[model samples]
Target: MDQHVKTLAHLFLDGEEDKALHFTEELLNEYSLMSFYEAIITPAMYYIGELWETNQISVADEHLATAICDFVISQIKGKETVRSGNDQSSGRALFFGMEEEQHYIGLKMVSESFKAHGYQVRYLGPNLSLEHSLIQINKFKPEVIGLSAALSYRLPGLKEIIKRFSELEWKPLIMIGGRMARKFALEELEADQVMIVKDLHHLSKWFEEGREGLINETS
Candidate 1:
C-alpha cells in the first residue's frame, strides 16, 4: 500500500475534495493510469465502502468519496484515449451490471482499462436486464460481454445472465468482476465463455489472453 494512497483515502473520507484531487494528481505523476487505478484509487474506494458498511460513514459521505474518485479516474481516462493512437478496432466490449445491481464504479474502472488498451467499450451501466443486455450485445456485437455484481444478492441476476449467454450460439466471451464476484464459480458456466477477474492485474491479463484467443479463433 502506497503511503500517499492512505492519505488520499483519508482526504476523500473527510470530504476534502480539492486536497483529495490534488493528492490524486500527485500520485498520477508517479503511476500509470491503470496502476493508479489498481493500486491507489481502487483500494481507496474499498476503504470507503468498508467505512459505509461498518456504519462509520453516512451514505452521502460515501457518495461524495465515490464522486471524487470518479472525477479523478475520468481525468486519467481522457489522457488514455489521447495516447491510444486511435485504434478503434482493437476489439469491442459491452459492459453492464445485473438488474437491480446499482454499484457501477468498479465496472466503470474496468471499462476504462479496456478503453486504455484500445478496446471500444460500450458501457451500459447498472440495473440492466438479461433481455436488454442481449439486445445490446446483438447491436454492439462486441467480442466480450462484461458483467459485474457488487453485491452478493445480485449474484443470482449475474448467474441468470451468464446462463442466457451460454445458451446462445454466437455468444461473446464473458468477464465478471466486482467485490462479491469471486464468491461464484464462473468457470462452471461454460468453457472459454466465462471468466472471473480477481483484480485489476488479472483483468489486464484476461483481456490480453482473451483477445489472443479471439484472434486465434477468427483466423
Candidate 2:
C-alpha cells in the first residue's frame, strides 16, 4: 500500500525488531496513536497475513513478523504518557482472545486504544477459556468486554461465548473484533448489547460518539 506501510511490513517480516521500532517511532511523529495503529501498523500486519495465506512466507516467518510487531507495540506503549484530556473515570474494560483463538496482536492493540482513551483495561491476551473469562468478568464487572478471533472456525465458539455473556445480569456490552469481524458479516451477532468493532478507527469513533452513553446504559 503506502510506502511507509510497505517498508514497515518488510521490517517486520525480516524480524528487524530494532529497525521496526525505529520506524514505528518515526510514524508516531506523523500520526496519532490511534491513526498509527489504524493506518500503518494494522495494514502492515494485514500484508504479512496475506503473505502467509498465499504461501509467500513460512509459518516461522509469520511468527517472526508477529513477534517484531508485538515488540514495536510494547516499545511505543512504554514511552508514551496517557492522552491529556482523557478521564480515568471512563470505565473498566476487559479484553481477550476467544477460546482456541491464538492471534492476539489485534486484541493487544484494542486494549491499548482503550487505555489511550483512559479506560481501565485488563488485557488477558490469547486463548482464554470461557470458564476463566467468566470468572474475570464476574470479578471485574467491567462495562465493556471485548473478544477477538482470527479464524472462521472460531465463529461457533464465538457465538456461544456471546450467548453466555449476554445472560449475565449486569449486561456488559459485548464487543467482537479481529480479522473475523472484518472478513465476515457479523451483523447477526449485533443486538442491543452486542457491537462489532471492525477496526481501531471504528473504535475511536465509538469512544468519541457512543462510549459515554453506552457505559451509562450498562451502569
Candidate 3:
C-alpha cells in the first residue's frame, strides 16, 4: 500500500475532512484525476471496507469515513473542468446504484470518469428504484446506462434491472460495475450491448477504443 493512501485512509477514518481534502489536493498536483481516483481514493476506501468487514471498525466509523471520502470527491470534482471534447449529442449517459444498494462512492467516481470524458451525465446516486430509473431513462434518453452493486446478494436485482433495461425501445448500452463486478466472471451478462467494466482504467480504455461500435450499434 502507498504511504499516501494509508495516510488518506487514516484521515477518512478519523473524519478529518479538511486534512483529507488538503492531502487530496496535493495528490491532484501529482496525478491526473483518473489516477487519483484509481490509485488513491479507491484503495483507501477498499481498506476501510476491509476494516469494517473484519469488525476492526464499527459501522458508524465506516459511515464517517465514507462521508469524508464523499466530501473529498466532491471537492476535487468542483475544482476540475470537464476534459472530454466529444459532442454532447453522442455522449449522454445515466448512472445509478441498484435498488437497495447504498454503496455509491464507486458509482460517483464512475460518473465523474464519464463526465471527464465529456459525457453528459445524470448520476442519480444510490438506492434508486426501477420505476424512477425508467422515468429518467425515458426523459434523458441516454446512449449509455451504468449500474453498480457492491455486494454479491444484489445479483438477482442487478439481473432484473438489466433485463428491464435491455427491453427498452432505445436499447442503450448497459455497463455493470463495482466490487461484485471485479470479483465475478459475469460472462452470462456480457452480450452485444452489455459490458462488465472492472475498474476506471478499463472504463477509460473502452472510451478510447472499445466504444466505437457498441455505442452506435442500436442506432
| lDDT per residue (tens digit) for residues 1-219 in model 3 | 999999999999999999999999999889878888999999999999999999999999999999999999887784444444444544789999888888999999988777777778999999999899999999999989999888888788888989999998988889999888999878788887788888888776686675755434422
Error of 2 at 212 (Å): 6.8
- Once superposed on the true structure, which residue ranges of model 3 sit more than 4 Å away at CA? 82-90, 213-219
Q: Which stretches of candidate 2 lie over 4 Å from their true place?
A: 78-81, 85-87, 212-219
State each model's C-alpha RMSD to the native: 3.4, 2.9, 2.9
How close is every model to the real structure, measured as TM-score? 0.85, 0.91, 0.90
lDDT of 1: 0.76
Ranking by lDDT: 2, 3, 1
Instruction: Report the C-alpha lDDT of model 1 over 46-143, residue by residue, as the tens digit.
Output: 77788899999999998888777777667668676666565565788889888888778889998888888788889999888888888988887887
Q: Runs in model 1 with CA error above 4 Å?
A: 84-88, 183-185, 208-219
Scanning candidate 1 in windows of ten residues, the lowest lDDT window is 210-219
In candidate 3, list every pair of residues with a backbone clash.
Answer: none
Whole-model lDDT, candidate 3? Answer: 0.86
Strongest candidate by lDDT: 2
Q: Is candidate 1 or candidate 3 better by TM-score?
A: 3
Ranking according to TM-score, highest score first: 2, 3, 1
Give the 10-residue window scoring lowest on summed lDDT in candidate 3: 210-219
Query: Please, what are the lDDT tens digits per residue for candidate 2 over residues 98-177?
Result: 87788888899888887776778999999999999999999999999999988888788899999999999999989999
